[model samples]
Target: MDRHAPSTRCAVITPQLSKRAARAGSDRRSPEARLEEAVGLAAAIDLDVVFKGLVLLSEVKPATYLGSGKVEEIAGIVQAEEVGLVFVDAALSPVQQRNLEKAWSAKVVDRTALILEIFGSRARTKEGTLQVELAHLNYQRSRLVRSWTHLERQRGGFGFLGGPGETQIEADRRQIGERILRIERDLEQVKRTRALHRTSRKRVPYPVAALVGYTNAGKSTLFNRLTRAEVMAQDLLFATLDPTLRAVDLPHGTRVILSDTVGFISELPTQLVAAFRATLEEVIEADVILHVRDISHPDTEAQAADVRDVLTELGVDPEAGGRVVEVWNKIDLLPEDERDRMVNTAARADATDRPTLVSALTGEGADGLLDRIESLITAGRVMLTVTLPAEDGEGLGWLYRIGEVMEREIGEDGLMRASLRILPERVDLVKRRFGAAQVRTEV
Candidate 1:
């Protein structure tokens, strides 16, 4: 975190594991683009990126992941630049990580560990902290073998009367096991609490719309633009760790709960995926999911595919009908001609599945985006006009609770008249709960 310190200097090495194999639907992004993303991730935590490069390998080494020659070359850079940390942009086995550290004589971290560090530092809420800690503990548990060699040493003893050294590794394992157990227990409680909250939300009439996309995709900025709440909409990756919710009223006066969740990334850490499952349940239960994209980014399509892959892993079909909305943001950063051309090109695409182009920073095309959301949410609703006695406050209140009241007026004869747009499923309920004769049909 100390940006001024020389010890914070780090080097990034992205290994090209395959020249023929490509990430699903991400062939457009070159390996260099992927390496730039890795460097950005390292910089997210204020790491001073002193050296970075690509290591092309036909095959991965079992022990060090990189060839011996490549390892030696990186080691020279590490020593010359005094890089205290080396970040490899790929998953590393425990043995590989240990061997790399020994060869380079520096602390080594893989992409997963680097992400966990950023999540750990950015988590603010108690639930967010607990989730991040659980993931960190799980990852640390797997690395204990490399970090502690004493665990492998055996103590000579007989039966229960073993030597004191026999207890060392056992105690360490037991301690870690116990901590994992405690964290799991705490997380289970958190999960149950979230479930109960979701259950309670079901009783509310508001439809839930969740915003999900790749890291730094301008989701938070769009969320702030729509909800008028000043959330931490920074340009940094993983800026929003905990899910935030705010009630947003659509153009038709229909209110929906809008949730902003943690952004997705390529090859998300498994520990994080398991630990953050409860947090991601919001996306699973959402009535609508908004897949926001940074249109200005060079790898936007690949990033979208990565986000969809994560969504699929979370049990939501990205291609499901009426389930996901694509929000292409950051058009304000483009030149006037380029922005117009991009918008026109998007318009020429299949309009049915095309994305909504908007600049969250400049508040352009936001109203049309809201109109699309409103139409989607209120697709099956029918507008109605109902009349209630002026003294019948209960009927009026019920109407406001379950439907969008577009207009209201009190007649001189003491009868209150109101116009509303309500869901089809609530029509029978309204007639039965209130007086059937009091309600009238319109539209």
Candidate 2:
């Protein structure tokens, strides 16, 4: 938090447990990729990675997660490198974390804690900050160990994570519990406000299109290309924490409200997922969902599976037919031959199951992507024509507000005739309000 303070010397240790553990957990990513991801997460928070290693674990130890010899080896590295913090790239229990800190004489944080810390730093909007804070408190509530050991000397502590050890661990937990409830209430209000905003957008001509994907998958780049908005599209993990919305006009004059949301990662902390549900509901309410992927990455399939898991957890059926679309981004980094092959494959696939291959960086294939999005947005929607008195311009304006005004005519009889494209849910409302001269159905 202090800009003038020195950077924390850090070490990242990814424990590659047995294949049995991997199979049980559905973790198919290689240990090297996991180690690389852990390092990226460290760099996201500006931690100087003095040491990075992946340990092949025969089994997880309850005391320190690593074997005693490995723990001692890391202690030597920490002392020699002066590592102030060590990130264990796996979940650790309170006892394991404390023992590791004692062995290495450094602040020991697990993957979940490191992620919470990065989120704490990246959050800009008040809603995002609240969500991160709530997650931190929930995580810290379980860590009733050394951080709360200093009881005699009265001093300030982490806002909600620590409380001077005034009464005891239970009292600290009480404080965290109270903060959690308050944050939950505030997030509920945020959810309601978000729902109201969705309702308001439904009264407009634009449809909601939300971007969802794994972290650092070029989603923000694609978003910037489509909307021409600067939204901190970086290669770092969790670069953009808050949600951003911008209006994008499709090729056929149809406009859409595009949303850029926080990216999902493998093994995302459950506390974060629970706390950010309000923010993630954007994907659920989206008229169209774009599942962007860094198709060039070696672990692209695994990354995609992780994202779908999160989507399923959020109550969105990833395979439920039409709402979700796969966007294979970052083709600019691919070999020309592979790129051509990918394009051909996409071209050969069935329309319903086809995925868009694009380079969000170079704007390659973006137009076609837009066309696909527009088609999906207008798919199965209703079409109707209404006639109104030319003097009743208010009714015409109302139609323009809610529906896509495709064709408009002013007749010699002083009556205005207009045709519209609207979501199926609003078809009945349009019929009841307009008393349309003719009604048509796309389905």
Candidate 3:
């Protein structure tokens, strides 16, 4: 039978681990919560979740990952419920996945594959498409074509999740290898283009602040609230896959580039992390990173820990203080007493570790969020007093464009005295244009 098309009817199973799964003990949420997320993942791709369950594993079985009796139980459910697809909410080995398919007589997808499916459907940009395709190819390469011996029909080159350009994927191993190479090469150029864009933005003196958090934690909502751009913000997992950037003026005079990026989830696939590193360069280079959280969720703490893990894997230290600001979002869903408690907790903490509670949907506490972001960006700046000849318009223009001009006046002696708050990195340029003695920090 050909399983090239996407399956509409699906069953989601969350396997609670008693042992290691890459970073064991990393996922500490209740199994019920995990099952809900798995169902949501299926929903993200428009799959109807007809069945969902929790499988307690004392030790993961090598053949099926589930016990033989449990496997038999699900097999009966598959036939009764007419499930065309089974989404196992854990990483399954090639052999394990094949065995499960044989037992259930349904297309079986592991957690990684389900997440990839969601990403494949959500990708809206060329760069996002490249990253998703690269990740899909990388993942599919490991599931050798030899595993599909029972299928009499010819298979497509695409991974488990079938989307656009499905016919273009060749079944030959060599062709898949070639496609991977081509995608990687294209991604390199995309990375270079992104770097050039960052360089250009640096010239304008606008600091980049990226939004990151657990999937569906209201990041895109907050981003839209701040930037006034209508990027996709829905109550779905991985709703916005493409990274979007918009400029917003803070409560203060400074402006910043607010980037809305793909949200993080617990046990994010390694293939995706390696493939999408190019797109996450913005978060790595951002001057301030807003770690948004759905404070009203029952599993909020677990979700926060998951986001921090992904950040650490990306070489960002979430606890390094000032750079990563925790934005407690979706407080509009919380009770009044709980909201007040969170506000008090945030108020008691120091600046570096404090969180800014806000309801992105209601426009509550937006000004405070902007102020916090501006303060962190401004903290790295130095106040400089520069004196240049009034006749030299070019030099005067550079200072105004490169820094925030707080005060300016023309001296009686054909000289312009201006005090500005300039980023620390740009201080040398000011000293180079004008004499070192003419530049002083009055404030």
- Clashes per candidate, residues 3 or more apart or on different chains: 0, 0, 0
Model 3 per-residue lDDT tens digits across residues 1-443: 12476657999988886655424654578778888988898888888799999887778898889999999999999999999999999999888999999999999999889889889888888999999999998898887544445432444446784432333333445687999999999999999999999998998778999999999999999999999999999999999899999999887678899999999988889999999888789999999999999999999999999989888988999997889999999999989899889989999999789999999999998999999998999996899999988787888788878998777789888788988889788888889889799999756
Query: Which prediction has more favorable lDDT, 1 or 3?
Result: 3
Residue 280, model 3, lDDT: 86
lDDT of 1 by residue, 1-443 (tens): 55566548899999986656444454557889989999989888989899999998877789999999999999999999999999999899988998899999999999999999999888988889988988887887777552344544454567674564556756766787898899889878888888888776665567889999999999899999999998899888898999999999888687889999998988889999998888888999998899999999988888988888899898899987577889889998888898889888878867557789999999998999888888877777888878888888888888887888888999898888889888888888888876678778785
Candidate 3 Cα outliers beyond 4 Å, as residue runs? 1-7, 19-23, 150-171, 385-392, 406-419, 435-440
* Model 2 lDDT tens row, 235-304: 8999889999999989987889999999999989998988888888889889899999999999999999
Candidate 2 residues lying further than 4 Å off, grouped into runs, are 2-5, 21-23, 145-148, 151-167, 424-443
Error of 3 at 324 (Å): 1.1
Residue 427, model 2: Cα distance from true site in angstroms? 4.9
lDDT of 1 at 406: 83
Q: Is 1 or 3 the stronger prediction by TM-score?
A: 1
What is the lDDT, from 0 to 100, of the residue 64 in candidate 3? 88
